[model samples]
Target: MSAELSGTEPNRTEPNGAELNGAQLDLALAELGEGSERWASTTLAARADLLARTGACVAAEAKRWVTAASRAKGLHKSSPLIGEEWLTGPYGVLTSLTALRRTLRAIDGGHSTLASRRFGRAPDGRVTVAVLPLNRYDGLLLHGFRAEAWLRPGVTAAQARDRAGLGQLTPTTNGGVGLVLGAGNISSIAPLDVLYELVAHNRVSILKLNPTFDGLLPVYRAAFAPLIEAGLLRIVTGGADVGGYLAHHPGISHVHITGSAATHDAIVFGGSRTDAPRFTKPISSELGGVSPIIVLPGRWSARDLRYQAEHVATMRLHNGGYNCIAGQVLVLSATWPQKAAFLEAVAVALAAAPTRRAWYPGSDGRMRAARTAYPAARLLPGGRLLVAVADSATPAASWSTDDILTTEYFAPVLGVVELQGSGQAYLDAAVETVNRDFLGTLGANILGLPSSIRRLGPGFEQAMARLRYGTIAINAWTGVGFLSAAAPWGAFPGHTMDNVQSGIGVVHNALLLDDVERTVVRGPFRPFPRSIAHGEWALLPKPPWFVSARSGALTARLLTEFAARPSARKLPRILAAAFRA
Candidate 1:
């Protein structure tokens, strides 16, 4: 019944859509369509003001918003994972809003300014723009991490500079309505998707909340009140029929979704073989894929082995391994002497990590399928991490040919496949393997020692250039690219609706670059102070994102607040909260 009571329940009933039928859906779309033209013509100053107001509103409701998310996901009030709710919920939404507002303000002043520095050109002629170290604060917080977005080839620096704010550069009088099918897993996905539609495409949007998290409709409404008042956005909740009606509605001009490829196919080509198409509107999506992590052969010290093992474990176990960008497959050098040792280290790290609630929908079925497919798969004691090692000799075996490579488990299972080779040979073959065998082209990771990287030299850069994924992280999780608002996050630039690998297009591109190909994020081989890996750094506490941390919620809250309004006075408290973990 009440919102407060709903939070305490482990699971809430899905909202019924019996009343969200044809007439109501038609009226909503009509209103959105009418408002789109006004939104398109609205002054940049006004748009910036609206976004600023929305960001403030989100910050004010941060606590209540995270509480609702944590409760629905069965996280205890004191659970460390409550920090995840904060990070992925209001914090994400506010960040996007603030970034968009800043961009708008810059554009309004007759010049577009982006926090991007050109990092030379790739072998393929694509210009690489390093977009991280976005500001002084980011440089301080992220330290050695840097993210770069590579533009499509044939576009000159002049052209990119001119097209930085394409939405503002090319204003159209004929704007239309867009339908956003929100995601269920992450609390911020829905609102952020809506923001993209409004800011990037100049479209007014009606966001249909997923049935799994429809209970937060009130929170979304409050945060987006300004947009709702301006008639540029609307938030609604309903089931399958509502989605069907909205998708096929004639008044809707475009559709955007953040869900599975199956859902996207069903919307575009109808649910069954015999049925006709349900929606002919232009559709875009950000779907899940079996992301892979390639580890090159190198001479790693004991500390390197342990640190990287923990890093890989963190990538796999974050958010209970429900993230779309989670590392699903581990590609290793079969001939490397330390292959077995590395695998053992990874298993040890995973086992030592804390267990998390399997709160995502269909997690049980997915985990069961993984286990059945690989009968010998090792299930860690807590039933959280599943490790399946494929036989390198039997390339045709079920373990190699099974759904593990093709399907996104969407659970805490990391499949390991070892390939033959050692140095440059290994890197070349590994890149080819991931390009051809990986399920989707959304995100990928490559982990190699600094010496190994330098030894490969041009070969290493060439290997990175050859990867087809939209986002590639070297010595880091691809999730970093997703969080960088300046970096475009999507599948590779070219994908038709017929064979959409990791959905159709990009989002979170605050610079509004239309010709983005992919984003590459590189982090240090080891963190600062070298000995920090052994828990010796005073300034940098264990990452609050680690599931094993105890003060995750408090740390997340402090971080969000600091990002919203940076102050030297608050750094001490933030570090204190982090150390408390």
Candidate 2:
């Protein structure tokens, strides 16, 4: 056990000076923690009312919230960068709200019987729906999948006299105050963690903001004023000492973290001065990983190739290659003859994309390590490497067995490894190799042709089922899974409290708040005259390409407008504007 938490800690003051006294923490919890069972007994209608108010609040404050997040993250306010994040960052929460509203509408229309509804089942066979509401938007976005998967076997027209526990309804069991250790790279994480605690586990949230963006804590507090006003949330800020003290405090009911695996291990297993691995409380974490983006070569036009290449660059360059979901390993299917050309196109795209700041912790050391392993890696001369593939692998790729594949370089280095075999064979082998050999089970991406996908059909399903990681992105990059709240986030097969990599429990969907092992599957077909074609790579910077920043803005605006109101007549105008942009 960790010495910081074990002996001489009970009823004694923590190592760091206290900012929030026990009484303050306790007072916050007593008010926020007492009404779980009571909430469970409340009608779904009442729950919907609360969620609606929360959604309205978010929508009303969307602009300010987004601007604050952009400033805090050091991103330019008007850049496509900020605009893109603004659209997708709070998407999960909004979608969850919509989902909840749909379910409630059905209930009002007499679909309340438990048997008539769907029930969510965990990877371990546990059935639960204990919801802690972060905002009204939480339920609207995630309830669709939950209802499809798990609803009780019976229904009642009048307030479910014998409804199964853990639906949109908040749980009665008060799990006390949880210490939320936020991530430095992304601002949305802290808020998302707060939502999970409130809706999933029925706990009062005590958020410890990562020092990386301590400057923005006041903005966060303001944005989340609803919860603060309810006395359900509190924000604290500091460095290691503050975090260490809070992690060990008895007042903390549970611990939730989103950061490095090293940090996670230090907190849970005890490293450095606290070398005994002693915290006996329940903790959940989503540690970082070297996510793989497998490119299955197949017949395609130059446009298709360009689109995929640019996407690869975007995924790598976004957040300056700091994202946990960033594409790390570029797995090539040897069966495809165009692999060489694809690599070249990727180089051109990377050279054109803007170089971003190398801001993540340990990014410098990790990037250097990657370069050392593959000296041939193009280090951008004046900019970051436009594209970096391991050169000359004589049947035994040096990087295959080294840290490149195992350790998440967490920088702008893109590692390419080629595999020889049929599409299914390569995919099956890669899945097995990655799951068994990789350090993390966070996320994985697959890029392939529709025909190849069809050929791999049942085998593909089998491979997806066998994957041990959390989020699986097929055809598209893994970032899509993170952006789309419709899917759950966490490891594919959630681990026990004893050990967790991608995290112990799922939080994105706002349902089934326990340790969830979720797999997300998606397939995209190329539209006619696809821009991401194989041969037409050079003319990528021209008009009609979505890769351009102008197009991205147009797309975001059009989608936002469409989401406000879906219309067939407006489709032509949106498409025309899309093409022009």
Candidate 3:
């Protein structure tokens, strides 16, 4: 039964792991170990069929899935805030499955889907593949947003297509079992990792659920029954002890984790650097870091300041500020005449945003630490903490030395840092500051008006090319990149295990392109109605992801159903809901 529809939710409990004893754990791992080889040889047709069936299962469980996740985050069934859970939880998973299924079906039909899409060359001649607007639905829903997965330097278009779907055409003949240490913050990440391991890498997987997400274990089990029934995957729940056991177990051939750098190091070196013990099995991770929301200075009116200010607030406060990519640092131009006004508007917007429970464990402690670090920290009406730093020509060194600038506070705590310049000079300096000072390489966002962006011209492109972050969003939150299945999500490449800033490798590259460097997603500065007046053609208004959207709950629900089984008939209601927003 649909909890939201029935006005009833399941009996809930505090987050607790379902830890297995040594024998039971060994049995589960052994089953996956034995099934790995068989999975490697599974025909593409069989794999596609499994994905198809899994989509059906996910749709069947979508309502319960979103309901449990919503209540877990302290949202009542009728609260508008439940919309966040719907979009990021089951909707994210369903859309990913839909995209992957399309990719596989294309491969089975003897064609590379990437080859059929529009491709462009960067200023440096690197190939950039469009990931969004995959069809009319994308074009209609996300209207103005477009994303491109930029390939690394020297990757030719033909070679890019040639390297895609690595193990699909010719399956791997190796014996392997993969361990995925799933992220706790987002409900979709764990299952998405399992799908990537099975379909992209040809490895059977054991997914270890983070204890914070223990409540959703049953939901995941129901949605991913296809893999479980096939013996290609095992889902387990436990604290750090069991995760360590699985990571160190010799039978686990490879490991993929979406977690913190400390956890990754502890697993690889067994928490001891004195002996220099190295556990060498293949490992890839998507560890998050302190992401900056860089705001470029522009001549603007009160409306523009308030609009962008609300956008800034949304960038930080979305998901109750629990997302890995939530913007932490607000980078502004010290010389811009409107800097103070913009800051004031941001304060008002944050204060006015609706309050939600600080649901994530330890969020209160984290916010307390941040407040303690900066005496200037002040709590807004909605309990959002904003800490302001003094302007400087080089704020990176002085600010970076402080823990507030270097740390990833996964809470509703945003800090403001002003750099000394404007226009092209400011753009270059801002990019340099975030790249040099920020702790993680996960994501960064830049916002600029049409006029300012046009004036900067090539300097903007050059700056984007130099940004070392994994995902870059221009006038959009990087969370957009995270939700897009076609976009490659992870840290920028070339981090060593010893200095794993944001960890290594990428996931969610449904195009299956090799040597992916980063994902660049761009969006209009304003939404529809306003966008029309501003000459930006985006048809969306107050996107469903926005916490302020009036129709977010219903629109998100429609999007989930549309992804599960899209139809032309469904577009009208989705659009109607969005237009109301």
Mind giving the per-residue lDDT tens digits that candidate 1 earns over 1-581? Answer: 32111211122233543355456666777777778878877888998998988888888778888888877778788767788888788877776787788788877888755534555687678787767766666676666678888888887777777788866665554548888999888898888888888888888899989877877877888878889888898777766666766776667789898988877776776654334444557888999798899998888888788878888887888877889898988899878888888988888888877676788889999888888877888878667545556646856344545587889888889888878778998888888877787788999999987777888898888888899999999988887787776778888867766676789888888777768889999877666556354333323445666666678789889878876666889887887787776
Candidate 1's displacement at residue 441, Å, is 0.4
Predicted structure with the largest lDDT when compared to the true one? 3
lDDT of 2: 0.59
Model 3, 55-162: lDDT tens per residue?
999999999998888877888888777778778888888888888888888888889968678888876888999998777789988999999988999999998888
- How high a TM-score does candidate 1 get? 0.92
**Per-residue lDDT of candidate 2, residues 421-523 (tens digit):** 6678888867876776566788888777767777887777677667766777665556555554434566555465445556666655533322334445453
2 or 3, greater by TM-score: 3
The regions of model 2 sitting more than 4 angstroms off are 1-44, 100-170, 272-277, 386-400, 494-499, 511-516, 527-549, 557-581
The deviation in Å at residue 80 for candidate 3 is: 1.3
TM-scores for candidates 1 onward, in order: 0.92, 0.78, 0.95
The weakest ten consecutive residues by lDDT in model 1 span 3-12
Give the lDDT of residue 419 in candidate 1. Answer: 80
Q: For candidate 1, give the lDDT of residue 180.
A: 91
